[model samples]
Target: MGFCGGCAKALLIVFNFIFWLSGAAILGVGIWMIVDKNIGSYFEVLNLDTHDQFFKYAAYILIGLGVFVFLVGFCGCCGAIRGSKFLLGLYIFFLVLIFAGELCAGVLMIVYRVQIEDKIDDALESSIKKEYGESVTITDAWDVVQVQLDCCGGNGPNDYVDSKFVNKQSEQMIPLSCCVLTNKGTAEENPKDAIAKNGTACYDKLGEYYEKGCKDGLLDWGKEHTTILIGVGIGIACLEIFGIVFAICLCRQVDREDKY
Candidate 1:
């Protein structure tokens, strides 16, 4: 039995229309951003720091995804008008591919280790005082890590102690981070929800960058760490455009297939 020529067709047509429109929008934004100085950040994230290679890859992928989505939408529209089952089936296959690709990319992004090195270049004022006595000013913050437990907390820290979060790796390997942090330094990767870790000698610097305390520190970090935001925003856009393409294909398939 073929698809009932009412709800399914209507659904497909609606989604196809939306995706086609979105495809154009994505392409437009990507193109404008590529040219605009303001949009350079997105390119960097998409490329992962290589100005030339990443920029090209990011631009191509974004534009391709948008165009693919537009094609899917167009196919759906044509299939609906012509009632072509082959076009519909092809659309369905493309939908699966697009969805799988985006899902895989997201998973890989989270799991991949980039070996981030964070440094606070600004020195505390000479007169600044700490509880110990005077806030010691270290010229280089290379080893001076500002620690936090809630790596995956309500908000994240400059340092994501995914290392400290679980015995995940330590179950097999000796956790390099936890040993120093717990023994010599301050902070917990897997902090007790009820209790935040204690001890000042360990030098636990408490405070959120955005919503909580340490407004100045957070502000400083914010301005300095804007590059990260660039990568994240563009990567997200790539995933989203991929999704739009999938939706378009799915709509077309539903229009062509037999069965709801």
Candidate 2:
């Protein structure tokens, strides 16, 4: 019995250490998502003006959960090492709470995915029509997407016609981001600064601009990375479950030793 208890305690400590590392990793990822400019551009594409809270809330939740997990892991290690029944019980409680919260978050993510699919077109149209060239944030976001995805406007250069950006231009033009950079002097230059290969006005140079629309480009990009996302989610869930079981078993061992 003494040997068994010692083994359980040692295993629990090791598990908690691993859990602590996982928490730190999650925290780092959460912070990165919040601050990374490239990632922020992707979020901007998904974020509708009226539904902008989603991105902020998602980041906050990740940060909060990461911190909570970090603390719980520390508590779990202490409880196992000192054989403190009270601390063990508290650790178990926190583990269960985190498990439940993660399930809820998963469901919420699925719902958010659906909502994004339904509203993305409308959001893109609204941004192009009213915010393009007018809102620096929106314009930068669109430019990033257009260049990275090799796409034009929401549905190609035609989608920009009669829009605020095009209307305000002195010459008939699409966004510089839409222009294809293939000229001898421009091919090596930055796409943002490169002139169009065929003509100055991007709308007239149909062959010189990307015909793919950003709307489809964004969706396809998400699909390409779905497997990675799902794998990460599953990995975290397994880690949480592993922590819960270890804490519970150690608590039982402690209780039996106390009664003996």
Candidate 3:
């Protein structure tokens, strides 16, 4: 029994160390998502104008959870090392709370999955009409999406034809980011010419640009990466469950020893 207790303590310490590192990684990712100007800006732009801060708030929430996890991990480590049942109990409570929250989130995601695409399209269309070129933030966000995904508008190149920004241009031009430059020079070097050969008209140069929209491009990317994401998510959840079980076992061992 003495040897069993020692082994449990060692396992708890090792698991807690891993949990601490995971928390740090989560915090780092959250901070990167929040501060890296172009990182998730495309998705952020899809939110309605009144809810523009949605992504920022979500990042903050993730950071908060990371901090909580980090602190709990530290508590668990100390409790296991010192044979303190109180700290282990506290860690168990926090683990349970986090597990419940994750389960709820997973359920909500499944419940809303069917409506998500329509909501995304509505938000993107609203953003284009209400705040596209009018705001520097919106314009930069869209530019990032177009350049990164090699996509044009929300649904396709034609989605921009009647947009305020394109209409305002004297020559009826989409953003240079939407164009695929065939010229050896940079896109800044007479962008219209860069997008097409000498005789190609702006509207007729459809082949020179991505016909697919950013929304579809992003959806396709998500579909491609879904398997990898699910694997990572499952791995993390399993680690958390293992940590919780270890903490509980350690606490029970401590209690039995104290009673004996």
Displacement of residue 68 (Cα, Å) in model 2 is: 2.1
Query: lDDT tens digits, residues 53-74, model 2?
Result: 7667877777887898889988
Write the residue-wise lDDT of candidate 3 on 122-211 in tens digits. 777766666667777777677667766777778777766667776676464566667665652543322324444332443455456667
Enumerate residue pairs that collide in model 3.
Answer: none
TM-score of each: 0.42, 0.86, 0.81
lDDT of 1 by residue, 1-260 (tens): 23455545666677676667667765875576467542342122122233467656766786897799788777766765566766766666676666566566545443432212122111121111110011112101111222232111112222223323222332312112212233332323221212222323112333212222122333344345444534544454454455445445445555556455
Indicate which candidate wins on lDDT: 2
Cα lDDT listed for each candidate: 0.42, 0.73, 0.69
Ranking by TM-score: 2, 3, 1
Query: Could you tell me how far off, in angstroms, the CA of residue 51 lies in candidate 3 after the best superposition?
Result: 7.5
Runs of candidate 1 exceeding 4 Å displacement: 1-3, 39-50, 108-260
lDDT of 1 at 213: 19
lDDT of 3: 0.69
Error of 1 at 44 (Å): 7.2
- Greater lDDT among 1 and 2 belongs to 2
